[model samples]
Target: MAGLAVGAVVVLALLVLLRRRYVVARVWGHSMSPTFHDGERVVATRRRHYRVGDVIVFRPRSRTTDVAWRIKRIAAVAGDPVPAWLETDHPVVPAGRVVVVGDNTGHSEDSRQLGYIDLAAVAGAVPHRAAPEGS
Candidate 1:
């Protein structure tokens, strides 16, 4: 009985902490190459808003899957004019949206391929990285 009560408390604490803090995700592609490599685990803080140059994870708009998470760099912010490539009258990054793209243009599928992601879709921003082996 004591163990069960302690377990329940621990679970509740985790739920509350996760709701207010960050999450961890393992990078799976080369989209953020050089900065974040495949197989790397990244720590994402959910409290802060994304800014230019910050690496963020967000779900893309897609038909086949309910969620499509990707890690990319924040290229623009709300109220900014749309880039020449994006054909939309709305600001590229509206008040609740973020414009993200991969550093490796050659192989990344990002905002350049899909479109801006809602701020709610942003899981968090990458904060720390583990050192590479032998480094």
Candidate 2:
């Protein structure tokens, strides 16, 4: 009986660790279509460094949408030249900031609309697709 209790406690601790190191969110818009579709579930691994072309989940500073969180692809990172299409005053992305955009640019409300995202606002990077449904 004591062994069973210890095993349960061990499992609980691991679960808590995993939760702190990862984020699971559901895609809600066509902004990332062709890559992540609406209604799809995705998992992101928490990390400190993110680079261009990496997909990430973040909390938007703007309240343009009702959703609590958003997913986008990194277009540029700190020290990189800002994309000309985005009308920012800075010639290059400032430190501790990143520019993100939707895969489907026409339908995305991304860096073009929200400006540079603070690294602190990011939840994590989508390292891979979510596990198969119902697994």
Runs in model 2 deviating more than 4 A are: 128-135
Write model 2 residue lDDT over 6-89, tens digit each, in one string.
999999999999998999988998988878899998898899899888899999997776887899989899999999988988
How much does candidate 1 score in TM-score?
0.77
lDDT of 1 by residue, 1-135 (tens): 999999999999999888667767777778777778898877788845667777887766674443346788777778777666666767545788777767776777777777887888788888744322331
- Which residue pairs does candidate 2 place in steric collision? none
Best by TM-score: 2
Error of 1 at 6 (Å): 3.5
Which residues of candidate 1, in runs, are more than 4 Å off?
Answer: 1-4, 63-68, 128-135
Q: Cα lDDT of all candidates, in order?
A: 0.73, 0.88
